[model samples]
Target: EEAGEHVLEVEVSLPELAELLGEELRLPAIRPRGREAVLSDVRRYRSIRRTGPESLRHFRRTFRTALRRQIAEGTYEPDRPVVVPRREDRRYRSWRIAEVPQSNAAVIYMMDVSGSMGTEQKEIVRIEAFWIDTWLRSQYRNIEVRYIVHDAAAREVDRHSFFHLRESGGTKISSAYELCSRIVEERYSPMEWNVYPFHFSDGDNWSGGDTRTCMELLREKLLPRVNVFCYGQVKSAYGSGQFKVDLDDELGDDGRVLTSEIPDREGILPSIRTFLGTGR
Candidate 1:
């Protein structure tokens, strides 16, 4: 009798998930633009050489070399099926330094943490942000994410606090945009980095004046500097849902601006497609 072995395994890769999302949404590849810089050096083993370290030895090539020599020299037996490699029969991998370009990106996520945005809405934003991060990372070699949460005031926070923290106040969308603009001007240069700003809210602002200010910031400050400005409106019971309407009326014709309404969990996928489908 022969013994049998059975095993089960599960593995997860973020790049694989990103590919799945891309297939599901039929997302297009992003076209990166900028001067090429040698940000990092990559080792590519593209050729087999006669000599290299033991760790870099090429097993198949060495075997083939040994077998060919044995057959030509009449040392190989067909029935025995044995191959022994001599010192000169050894083969190894050779690598060359590949310069990777400096195509970096920054994703600034701003969310409304006002009293009206409930836990359920925040959960939706969290789910959406995960997908967004996965897709953007796949498109760029290096990506950095910044999080901001706001009510009447806006402040930057760490990843954990961004999703979990809650606040009670009026919604002033402009404050978040102003902070985002300042961050871009201070740290990320549009000339070198692809900037993406994603804002999630319940379509509630403190006043029409603040809404105007937000539009001004988008038009004068953010639109020209960013690849695209994405606005996601998550529905809430207390929210009036007027901000999206205003945005459509004001900036709907602009190619650099995108807006989507996330009514619930079901809307997450479509919203992601809407935001990233342009491949900007």
Candidate 2:
């Protein structure tokens, strides 16, 4: 009976994820809109100087010229082959800064570090975050990533600390939202940058009041500036899982707002697809 009660499990390939993501999310490449152009150092051999380093010598041209000179000057010896290049033969490539404009993007990642959110929940966020970063980077020439973690409070952290952060205290979803809003306003302007702010949690807030604060922040402050606000509510055993419902009720039929329920590690890719699929 146990042998016959088997189920089919499909394995998702990483290469296929990239292909599927491309098909599902057709985000337009952002074009930079700014007066200040980005500077890039480029090497060119357009101008060959009389004296230069050996590295950039025009070997073929120099050899041909030397052969002509040697033959004309009666220095050519067919019996003993020897052709020497003068200092004029040497040419070095010059590098100059080329100013170019490019569309830029920033991804702000926020997560609940509260006790109810366990290791597995954080793991889901980590995996999804990796894929999201890859996809966004592919779409933009310049990409900035910021991480915020919150329990009863929120704080900005480095990438290493952000994913490794452990569960603690109670959840105050508002703190992370508030910080994320500030980052968007200060660093990533709507005109200059294509901003993407993503939040991950177990859908457990300190209270309905804090949830209201989060909603206000999203609706009033964040949504206006960012390209999109993505929220992934990872399932947790100790979590109430009510915040997902709250977001749904408060923010109805909003194209810019995306929310996904990630049940486990396996849900990471699907959650990412749903969040980024809107093509905002």
Give per-model TM-scores.
0.75, 0.68
What digit string (tens of lDDT, one per residue) describes model 1 on residues 35-147?
54235576657567998899878776788899899999999976566788998999987877755445988999999999999999999999999999999887778899999
- Relative to the true structure, candidate 1 reaches a TM of 0.75
Model 2 lDDT tens row, 1-280: 2223323243444433554567665543334443322544444244445566767565655666777878888997766667876665444444444332356888999999888877788787888888888776655568899999999999999999998888669989999999999988889877778888899998888998989998999999999888878888889898888999999889858887888888888787678777776655
How much is the lDDT of residue 85 in candidate 1?
92
Q: List the residue pairs that clash in candidate 1.
A: none
Among these predictions, the greatest TM-score belongs to: 1
Candidate 1 backbone overlaps, count: 0
Q: CA lDDT of 227 in candidate 1? A: 91
Stretches of candidate 1 exceeding 4 Å from the true structure: 1-9, 36-101
